[model samples]
Target: MNDQPILLILMIAVGLYTFNLWREDCKNAQAGKPSPSALPGATPASAKACIIAALGALVILIAETWGELRLGLSDQQSKITVLFGIYTLIAAFIEELIFRGFIVIENKGRALRWAGVAMASVLFAALHPFLWKWEDGVFAWTFSAKGWFSTAAVFASSLWFYTVRFASFNPHRSLLPCIVAHATKNMGVILIKGAQGFVVGLF
Candidate 1:
């Protein structure tokens, strides 16, 4: 689980995706395309907005479902925080770079926008898998389309839609909520593990 190969792959993917998205904009600006910045608003840059977003995120924290997904405590219980901590930190930044920074900001087309969302969903779920036993070799279903699709759906609804970038659909113009929402969600899970003893593992 601590292998560097996956991390290296992630790094390469992010760089390639960003270059693909922004290269056209770069070339176009050189030619004559209009320039428009597309960075999302993070917390603190907007005090009131940040507070409101944080509050909203707290609401999501209360509703988080990941804790329920855990069955019981294992040796991994104590280290749950470490695993999710890295997951939250790395995923928060990397996913943003891939989705909003590159995909949405670059294309802004409806179809491409959804494609970006779908791509992010798949990647995110692939990172987090359900419980596995050592003797099984590989969870046969893990490589199946149904398995991937279900996990992707869960990831999309929870992490992407219910948590991050709700504005991608409608009714939301602010990005602060997304950031705060993610933070609160991660923190809430941490609290649950401490208080009630729900544990998550990394394969």
Candidate 2:
């Protein structure tokens, strides 16, 4: 079975989920009870935070991909560059909405919020199917060393995004920083992989 269709369906699902969040926020605003954390507009401080988060994410991506860069590249080109790009952006937005926007925003008090963050981070990591492999059209759990490492890396990345989502001291919470950071990380990975492909082609 081709994984591309599965990925496309997942992307659409995520997009719909994000759209529902936006719709709900709009409805709440029209009802004269605006949500404080309703995807607030980015302020100057948030913009700075976004830059910081993006840089941090980029550093992480570089570190993680360094081995891949050093290794001999594959001559085969990526067929899903455009699909992957769109998917990454949509996935990042969906993750922010589910983990940071809904979970963190709905939970009250510091303790609850932190708990929510932890739960969401774990869920976020687990939801990433890329860490595992599918065999004979069935999902398989190898629990290999690489799988564990990938899952851990994903968990850490999710935690970083969550931190950025609520890093602002402002009253309103903006997910812009987290989204920017996530997108930066994804783009960095894509660029590195593309470079690897180019290097391989030269061989």
Candidate 3:
């Protein structure tokens, strides 16, 4: 079975859902209670949080890239096209909305929240195809030491995303920082892949 159709449908679904959430957030802001959602909050603190989170992502990505080079690990990334790159960018936001926005347990104690973060991070890392692959509608499992290193890096980044969402720097628990951090990492991956000649054509 072709995967493009499935990916297209999934992308549309996520786009619609994210748009609805933004609409709801707009209404909430008008009502003076935005709650914890994916809205990029309007405040200096929000901007600062995004910058800090993005810098942290840069650090992690740099280290991961260096490690991959040192280990002589080939880039397992799929070929990049304009459409694929766009989808990946949107995915950065949608993933944060789901993993960092929906999976969070606000108003619960710190222990429970951290527990949820850990579980979400594991699930996040596992879904990235480092330990498994799905192609032509067939699923297969594969792993390597280098793949484990990459997966672990993903897990660590997820933890940082969660941290920026709930850290004291972001008192409103805004998802902006999480989105920024995720986008930074994804863009870094794309650039690295392009530099390494994994990118095919832009379109």
Higher-ranked by lDDT: 1 or 3: 3
Residues 95-145 of candidate 2: C-alpha lDDT, one tens digit per residue: 776676666645478778778778888888888764556677788765654
Alpha-carbon runs more than 4 Å astray in model 2: 1-45, 67-81, 105-107, 135-137, 169-171, 198-203
Query: What tens-digit string does per-residue lDDT give for candidate 3 at 1-203?
Result: 12364675578578768756765785676577765743554222457788999999999999998888888775555566655666777788788878887788878899999999999999999998778887777899888887798899999999999998888998877776888898998899888888888766645
Q: Which residue window of length 10 is worst by lDDT in model 2? A: 71-80
- Which residue pairs in candidate 1 have backbone atoms (N, alpha carbon, C) closer than 3 angstroms, thus clashing? none
State how far residue 76 of model 1 sits from its true place (Å). 12
TM-scores of the candidates are 0.47, 0.69, 0.83
**Which number leads on lDDT?**
3
As a TM-score, model 3 comes out at: 0.83
Candidate numbers sorted by TM-score from highest down: 3, 2, 1
**Number of backbone clashes in candidate 2:** 0
lDDT, model 3, position 190: 84
lDDT for model 1 comes to: 0.47
Model 1 misplaced regions, further than 4 Å: 1-45, 48-61, 64-87, 105-108, 131-154, 157-177, 199-203
Clashing pairs in 3: none
C-alpha displacement of 20 in model 3, angstroms?
6.9
Predicted model with the maximum TM-score: 3
